[model samples]
Target: MPKESSQRGPTADRLHRVVVIVDENSNPFELGCTTEVFGLRRPELGRELYDFRLCSPAPLTSMRDGFFTLTGVAGLEAADSADTLIVPNRPDVEVPRRPAVLDAVRRAHARGARLVGLCSGAFTLAEAGVLDGRRATAHWQWADAFRSRFPAVRLEPDVLFVDDGDILTAAGSSAALDLGLHLVRRDHGAEVANSVSRRLVFAAHRDGGQRQFVERPLPDLPDESLGPVLAWAQERLDAPLTVADLAARAAVSPATLHRRFRAQLGTTPLAWLRGERMALACRLIERGESRMDVVARRSGLGTAANLRLAMRRERGVSPSAYRRRFGPRVA
Candidate 1:
């Protein structure tokens, strides 16, 4: 989807409404993910991005594994007014979702509101029949069960998340944050998403296609974290950086660096670098940089043609089209 500007200082009705359904046995982690991503006040942006709220079928809801009892939120009708409705996650995937919850999801989809499923929340979506013939993901541990239960749904079980136009799904716990940040990036542009990510101290961009897990044995020697190298590369994205350069900076061979990147970030170094450059390009575009060549140069994409290719390849839109969608408005 093309990026959309977070209309700064918009009226109440203009703000995007994000409502989360806190169902019985729902997980709190994803609830916190939604709250942190869409519900919080962005004083840093000098505005709030969404008119966020929580809703439930009943006044008292039990959290996953009996963590706690949640109460005093809006009713399920709150979801009807939402621009995005986040379905709840529960650990027990075998158990069926409430009929009312499924109906709410169906209605939300019928009304053209965005639907999100985090972790086992995919089960809710599948149970609701909205995921039929749709690409979706759930925690890898339940891949067999999900495939067995929803034979019609295209389940991409290994990735972190799947964004199928109006509907999105994330695999497992931490991926909820990945999908949430993705939504922010989709709705408000890269700069705003990065700001929110920095505030949360989380990685701003994790490709939804990245693997959910890496099965690597523990290192015999002391583990060399990739944090410093990644930070260094991010600070100098405009420079001509190669795998050798990154390996040299990290005091490791290119092969070793590749393994570490896969284990830690679940993506290749080059892929990560390209993603960062594209994000920088988006930020530049969003800041009203009119010249495509300038955006390409500063973002280390080399040329305007390469910029357009990258934008179209990764963002599914041309640079000019993205700029038109998300660029600053004239007073």
Candidate 2:
């Protein structure tokens, strides 16, 4: 378990009303993610943090997986009074959204309600035009199609999620849970979010901009794949590892290592190494380590200057700022 932060405080005073918009053939896992985060009662707090409601275009709807049907759902008008409006994954993104749904989403944003999209639900937000000129993300599988349809939105497909202030967009099914916990962390502080995470058996916080876990096609010959070599490199992140070193560890020539890395990880050896080092630095920062030099050395990033440059280039934030947002706070 991680240490509790001392800077815990309510982000807002009043109970927040959250409304989830369900469309026909909605994804149950996405809806359940929202419900699990906002709908549950937290007696530990002595008061509810969110008043969660489910509203759909219709009162009854069947889910996409065809295993469950939802009933007692409120109409679109229910969203009119919500503090946050969430859209879960739909059956398709290419299909046009209902005008009524678009209008409600636009109106909610115009009235200052926070808007969220889980997975392909980002398509609906894009259709509503609320995502225009804003940074957002969706499941990586739909990256090309999403870009083709909505060229105006700056889509970052690699990320777990994107929090562009009032509009939050999550990448895929599991990313929805990350975004949901993020909302809790944003509204009720880390202590409460961590408590909720423990109950849910989920990671309390994953930086939204962290890269998605992409699946790669591996070679049939296990020896040809670089999995073991990658693991070895990970264990030696603090060491001055090189392409030649990696090649030696894998018992392959540097040229062969390059080919295998491209085929397996879709990146160069040095680039992948940098990404791993940056990820390690982020974890160290989140754990409340304040010494930049120590963090850089531990992560094999070399110096405080290099860490700052890498963080800025990759994560768009300074080390101190990242720590302030994620590190354990002292009283």
Candidate 3:
């Protein structure tokens, strides 16, 4: 199947209706990411897009910093009004969502608005019955907790986001960018998403799921060791770059490079490269409307069959299916 961007449906030309639900003690990392993507204006992204509003359960709110912030209670009424709604990292991990907040999420979802749950925010969505029988994801660290709490929802803790039609869930922290860029791709087409990534100076794409295999207790390795080489390799994933090529570029032997990668990133050079390739391939499928053959060639995945195997093994979707679902077209 070809990964063609859908030339159909109501394009996400603007997000004039957007809301972010913030609660007391929200994780700053995830909340900040939401604000950066939707709350802040980027004229460079589009002349007209995203009329972002911060929705709070109460008329007044408090940030993680413990300072009270005055905000209009974009209560259930305001939440139900948006075209899209975001739930950043939850504040009360030990406690379940309050009745009012849960009701607001259900109301918004019922109104046909897209709902996103970042990190443990999925717990709230699950409480609202939004993720019943749907495949969802959360930060790898919380995978066990999530499964215990929401056993009915198929939990995928490795990937960045699980795009289950109107409901989307992402892993921790930086994974928010993966889902945010995905939303851009879905709403405005590949061109718009690519433009936004470029403006933000993010690589136009990154392949693979989130870091479930992350080297826990990551060593405080010297930045001078591997950072520069990573940037160089990322810029050239399409090139015929090999471990030997990276070794040469990084001024190290292949043996040293392999050891360094294992010590720092918890994976071999080739595996990381493969992950990056698949991730880039997914971006191309959604954004460029590129076929599998083209994506395979561009991402250095070797062949269409290899790309198919990798995409399926990683995402459980064929390239065409993924493109169609995440493509600008709804169908």
Candidate 2 regions exceeding 4 Å error are: 1-19, 32-54, 72-85, 111-119, 133-220
Per-prediction TM-score: 0.91, 0.67, 0.69
Candidate 3 lDDT, 1-331, residue by residue in tens: 1121222124456445767888766776777677666666667755554677877777767666675464664665577667777864554666776687788888877667788898888888888887878888887777888888889898887776777767888876677776777777666555566777776667554432434454533468544367788889878888988999989988889998888887666567898887677767877876645577888888888789988899888666788777776655553
Q: Each candidate: how many clashes?
A: 0, 0, 5
Candidate 3 local accuracy as lDDT?
A: 0.72
Scored by CA lDDT, what does every candidate get? 0.88, 0.82, 0.72
lDDT of 2 by residue, 1-331 (tens): 1112222223445568889998788888898899899999988766687888999888778888677788888988998978888975786778788889999999988787888899998999999988889889999889999999999999999989988878889987789999998888766545667778998998666667666774455557455767688889999899999999999998989998887776655567888888778878877887778999999999999999999999988655799977877677679
Query: Which digits, one per residue and each the tens of the lDDT, describe model 1 over residues 1-331?
Result: 3122223222446788888999989988889888988888888898778999999999999898887999889999998887888998898888888899899999888777888899999999999998888899999999999999999999998899998878889996789999988988887788888999999999889999999997565778586789899999999999999999999999999999999999888899999999999999999999999999999999999999999998999887899888877799788
All candidates in order of TM-score, best leading: 1, 3, 2
Which is the winner by TM-score between candidate 1 and candidate 2? 1
Q: How many steric clashes does model 1 contain? A: 0
